[model samples]
Target: MTTAVISDSSSLIMVGKLKRLDLLANLFQQIVIPHRVATEIQAKEDGVASLILAHPLVSIAATTRHELLALLDGTLGHGEAEAIALADEHQMILLVDEKKARKAAKNMGLKIIGLLGVLLLNHRRTHITGQDAILMLEQVKAMGFRVSARLESDFMTRLHNPITHWHSPNTLK
Candidate 1:
């Protein structure tokens, strides 16, 4: 089974925009969003807020490590810092999309996943077909997810070569 996931704002926003929050719901046992991340997403007029609010497995977690958060305050967004701190406290995996935040979380020794990673997970689990996965990836990328050219190309290449790429989704790191 996949590890527990704590999501930041970007992952929520991206998957919410894709209307595929169900993917996260199915991919992980539970998903915890940090309080600051929830606050940042609360005002958004996207499907993510409603889905997060209504989902039974999704909950908001407050970060108590003020010093850790303060240290990361300037380097990362409030939501990202709180999410990272919360994940660190609980020893859960992080689901973040921002490049800098992802790098920081990794530097802190946290296992990380991103929006595209979740999609790929679904595909690996046979929850979605390769074609469907590719289509969803294209949709998210087109919606301004800021995927690097090499990563985009890699996903496409992997999707087409299942024999070699049929590894665990956690390899997304």
Candidate 2:
């Protein structure tokens, strides 16, 4: 089973874009977020927060001060660092949307994935079509999440010419 531990930013990104969460839940065997991440989402009072709180597959894990301290020296932000630490300590994949957090996780030899990566995985798994993934990306954009031009171009290309094989590096890129 694939286990993922996500930071607050990624959690908010998923919650803010509700459709993506369904796709992620379908793709991963287990989804976990730090308790702080959950609390932040709840404070936002968005539909994404309520949906995650009610989801059967999502789990909320608490953070330890020790783990947080370990990540303090990394390039990740407070929430993201804590999330990466938890994932690394527990031997789970870290789902982070922040570029610095992703890089920090990579430098630390921790597995990572992002919101866009999860959507691509859903498309590759046939859980959602390429067109559907594009539509969801639009939804995420509408929710005010930042997306890069390169990602937009790549997503359009994928939508236009859907890949036949479901390779990890390709789907997650």
Candidate 3:
């Protein structure tokens, strides 16, 4: 896969779960964060920012005014806007979780995926086991990330095997 530039909120959420970061860093060629996103993270004084900065696969890039405005006009919120802008300017995939922002990105023909999507991809790639994927999802939830019931169900189905009962919703739940 090509490099993906994540905006602040998603990166913070991802890095907060160290295991998720380990998986992502291994999956992608590179992970870039806009300078604005980095600045926001730096202000938090949490390990997320430091971890991202220190990661060999991750880097920061400054965003321009034009790109910022375009993002603002897009469906992205302030933080996500900067991320999308950076991704668009660099022709990289934008890793975002906001609904409106995702819709806007799709409208603009930009490749986008949310936190759940990333986790699912990791699970599919065998970077994380099905159980670990569920654990990561729970961790993100504890950190205040939202996951819709439908999305959760869909992901669980992907992790299930038709010939076995290991991942049946009743058993997993």
Number of the top candidate by lDDT? Answer: 1
Stretches of model 3 off by over 4 angstroms after superposition = 65-75, 161-173
Show pairs that collide, candidate 3.
none
Off by over 4 Å in 1: 163-173
TM-score of 3: 0.81
lDDT of 3 by residue, 28-138 (tens): 788777776777777776566777778787788766757555748555566667776776677667777777777666666677766666666667667778888788788
lDDT of 2 at 80: 76
Single out the weakest 10-residue window by summed lDDT for candidate 1. 164-173
What are the per-model C-alpha RMSD values against the true structure?
A: 2.5, 3.2, 6.2
Better of 1 and 3 by lDDT: 1
Cα lDDT tens digits for candidate 1, 4-67: 7988988778777777778887788888988888889888876578877677878888888889
The lDDT of each candidate is 0.80, 0.66, 0.66
Runs of candidate 2 exceeding 4 Å displacement: 4-7, 11-16, 64-70, 73-75, 158-173
Evaluated at residue 14, the lDDT of candidate 3 is: 64
Task: For each candidate, give its TM-score against the true structure.
Answer: 0.89, 0.80, 0.81
In candidate 3, position 28 carries an lDDT of: 75
